[model samples]
Target: MPEVVFSVDQSKSMRDQAVPGHNRWHPDIPVAAMVRPGDEFRIECREWTDAQLGNNDSANDVRDVDLTHAHML
Candidate 1:
């Protein structure tokens, strides 16, 4: 599982605050910190396309979204 070692940006300007469901990314599950230089972990990701974004969604929708976070084992 991923662990927090360094730190995360919780500042008002650094936050990714957006509405859920309407957007694929945003209104994120907040986390603080990072992993070390040598850490036991793997990053799993997914790809969301136009089918997921719909016609009204814009590029800016995911621009401020932060996908980095720690996962529990």
Candidate 2:
């Protein structure tokens, strides 16, 4: 398996990761990892909504999710 450069825990929010990710990208953000050409690496990520929507028949989570924090990263 490729080395996990940036790891994420699906059970938790992106902001709760070891190296938390931001909701939006910016050039000022520090590089999370570096790799040379041909290098293979893995980056685990959570859902764009940070799992705000759960695995259930009810759409309450989706309907009530805060749009202000739509994307996790």
Candidate 3:
């Protein structure tokens, strides 16, 4: 199993704004306050199904993407 740590950023430049990305349309939260000593966390940090595909990409090209697995993190 692997682990990822998310440290809270208290930078003065931090702002309350919407994050633009896949599944991230909401306002950003204070990362420092979210995680606790034993809280569980995991993220699928891999190339998405549509990453290298172009506008003319076909259905077969989009299928069978290697989805990220769940490891202890």
Candidate 4:
């Protein structure tokens, strides 16, 4: 994987908001705080089961989803 760096802006409005879907990356604490200009990390992004479930799947699949084992994109 290639190295990634974040340059974030910390403004008053942003401080009160949260990053959707990522509890760990709150607006108050920008990604810049955790990474430098040349740091690298394995980033994993995942979607809600309800959002990605196939048409053939039942609602039960979403209800039964185990967040702990959910796939990361």
Candidate 5:
């Protein structure tokens, strides 16, 4: 496999949701310090849903999501 390096943001926003198949949103640790020129890796990212919610939305089908449940991830 081709080696790759990654520089990720580990903020709470970057943390993974509790989706059934997936565990966390991002890697447990940072790899920017350990990655070499040829190392390859994959990155998991959060969805835009968390960022695009309005206060008016209250129902499950509403576009405005509270992001309260991990299943939304």
Candidate 6:
């Protein structure tokens, strides 16, 4: 198994990450990781909605989720 270069804690927000990731892409956004070509590595990420949607059979979370800071990268 490849070593994990980046990891995410589903229980927390992107900003709370040890090396916080960004939702948007920009040159100003610091590089989260760097690897040599052909390097096998892993990056664990949370849901795009940051788990705004629930696991149960309910669509309310989807309907009411505030996507103001979503699509976590």
Best by TM-score: 6
> Please, what are the lDDT tens digits per residue for candidate 1 over residues 1-73?
5643433232212223221112223445444334667777543222332122334577764664444421211
Candidate 1: residue pairs that collide: 5-34, 7-33, 8-33
Ten-residue segment with the worst summed lDDT in candidate 1?
A: 12-21
Error of 2 at 25 (Å): 1.7
Put down candidate 6 lDDT per residue, 1-73, tens digits, no spaces. Answer: 9999988887888888888868888999889889999999999998888778889888898898888978989
Model 6: how far residue 48 lies from native, Å: 0.7
Q: Of the candidates numbered 1 and 5, which has the greater TM-score value?
A: 5
Estimate candidate 1's alpha-carbon lDDT, on a 0 to 1 scale.
Answer: 0.34
Query: Which lDDT tens digits does candidate 2 get at residues 1-73?
Result: 9998888878778877778888778998777788899999998887777787888978898788888877876
TM-score of each: 0.23, 0.83, 0.21, 0.26, 0.25, 0.90
The reply for model 1, stretches above 4 Å from the true place, is 1-29, 48-73
lDDT of 6 at 16: 87
- Candidate 1 TM-score versus the reference: 0.23
Q: Which ten residues in a row have the lowest lDDT in candidate 5?
A: 14-23
4 versus 6: better TM-score goes to: 6
lDDT at position 42, candidate 6? 99
**What ranking emerges by TM-score with the best candidate at the front?**
6, 2, 4, 5, 1, 3
Greater lDDT among 1 and 2 belongs to 2
**Candidate 1 lDDT score at position 16:** 32
Write candidate 3's Cα lDDT for 1-73 as tens digits. 5345432222211122132123233355334324557777743332343243335758754564433421111
lDDT pick, better of 2 and 5: 2
Q: Residues 4-39, candidate 4: write the lDDT tens digits.
A: 332223331222323323334345744533555666
Report lDDT per candidate.
0.34, 0.82, 0.35, 0.41, 0.41, 0.87
Pairs of residues at least 3 apart in sequence or in different chains that clash in candidate 2: none
